[model samples]
Target: MRYRALLAFLAAIVAGLMVVSLLVGPAGVGPVAGIAALVDGKGALGLVMREIRLPRALLGAMVGGALGVSGAAMQGFLRNPLAEPGLIGISSSSALGAVIALQSGFAAVSVLALPGAALAGAVVAVALILMLAGPRGPSLTLILAGVAISALAGSFTSLVLNLSPNPFAVTEIVFWMLGSLSDRSMQHVAMAAPFMAVGALLLAPLGRGLDALTLGEDAAEAMGVRLTRLRLMLVLGTAALVGSAVAVAGAIGFVGLVVPHILRPFVGARPSRLLAASALGGAAMLLSADIAVRIIAPERDLKLGVLTAIIGAPFFLHLIWRTRGQIA
Candidate 1:
């Protein structure tokens, strides 16, 4: 009952935030004007609201929701609540791919190019991890592989920036890594929506498997879950969702790691319930962050990712401190 109510409240809040994102800009547009323009058409306020802020707001919700659900699924699959897209290097690889494409000057022709390369990079990282883990390797091996991939991708990104001729490329790369929803457009939405959709579809059904996984691989296998196939589905889905998010939005952290855990209690630790609840919570968190990013600057918009880091970093540190003993 609470879960359903909370979701409803979040939906209402998201709707309100969308309204605020549309109107609460430095341009002095109000919701009334924005909506009027949207409905009536042929107004400057309407166009800017429709073209700029609306797409960004929607993308923030979409990407944030995908990350949240993906994170929950990962944590379930790994039996580790701390697992996140970044920890496994998917985001880094995605960012590297985006950087390569952007630096190649394809981004100049179309912003969508980077996202494609990022997806490619994400798939590569997942493939490498799977190959390293093999069919029967332990979970720990897969984690180690992910860590190595992250380090490699990060170093390669730095090296690429250093080698790039365009001075602007370095700054751009840094900002992109920081994560931001600012200035995002329909092109980015187009690049990411299909992938994110696919990810959601993959993950929503894994709730039962997640429950089985909490009892360990052998236990899950005993419960009729095919361990290898389940793991493959999780890895591939997470890669597609997260890869596309990084491709479109860069590396927005904490949404995955934070949302599920925060809402775990509300849903009573059931992985399936947590999945849907966190999806809503994550959407709210990101959309709210987008609102914050726009209003806080109103003029000098910071990246949505930056704000999330500022907010998530402390939470993350506390989590690390809390879990250090456990991980060790």
Candidate 2:
């Protein structure tokens, strides 16, 4: 009953935020008029509500949910509270792909090129991670492989940025790298939603496996939890989630890391319960951040990723401070 009530409360918060997200734009539409315009779909207000705010709100929720659940699964699998979705290099690799697309003018050629390239990069990184980790490798191996891939991808992205001759392209790349939901359309929602749904499906059944994993691998294996299968599903699902999110929204940081950490205590530190709660918490966090950016600097195009980093970096430091004794 308690868990259900918690979920219900989080869901209510998410729904309320979604509504606030739709209403809190530069246009300053009232709640009733904006919602009515959304339903009617007839005039300029309808277009603004449907095309601009709706997709931004939806993507904010989807991206936050994906990052939240991915972070929860990684931390659960690794038995490390510091584990994050980007720890596996998917986000970096996706960013690298988007950079390549922009540098090569492929992104300008078509609406889908950037996302397609980003997805391709994520697939390649996943393949590399799996290959390097091997099917039966331990968690340490996965961590090392992911670190290596992230380093390599980051270097490549820097190289592209350094060599690019087009100033306009450089500005676009920089802005995209910073991440934002401004000017996004329904096409992005259509592109990313299916992949996020697939990732959700893969991650949904992981509650039991993750719970069993808390008992250590040998014990978990003895109890019918297939460690190999669990790792594989986790990698694939996280890749899909992070890949699709980065493809559309660029690399928004610390969401996966912060959301799960904040909600874990509320869920009694159970990986199983943390999954759903973190998803909802993440949506609320991102939506709130998005709204904050709009309100704090309505005229200045504040980047969502920058705002999240500002919020998350200090929390990260605080977490490290608290865990310093454990680290030593």
Each prediction's Cα RMSD? Answer: 2.3, 1.5
What are the per-residue Cα lDDT tens digits for candidate 1 across 139-162?
Answer: 788788889999999999989998
TM-score of 2: 0.97
Report the C-alpha lDDT of model 2 over 1-328, residue by residue, as the tens digit.
8888999999999899999999998887999999999999979999999999999999999888888899999999999888999998999999999999999999988788899999999999999998999978889999999999999999999899899999898899999999888888899999999899999889888998899888988888899998898899899999999999999889999999988887876888889998888888888888888888999999999999999999988988887788689678
Candidate with best lDDT? 2
Whole-model Cα lDDT of every candidate shown, in order: 0.82, 0.91
Off by over 4 Å in 2: 319-328
Q: Pick out the ten consecutive residues of candidate 1 with the lowest summed lDDT.
A: 22-31
Estimate the lDDT of model 1.
0.82
Alpha carbon lDDT at 270, candidate 2? 88
Regions of candidate 1 where Cα sits further than 4 Å from its true position: 317-328
Give per-residue lDDT, candidate 1, residue 286. Answer: 87
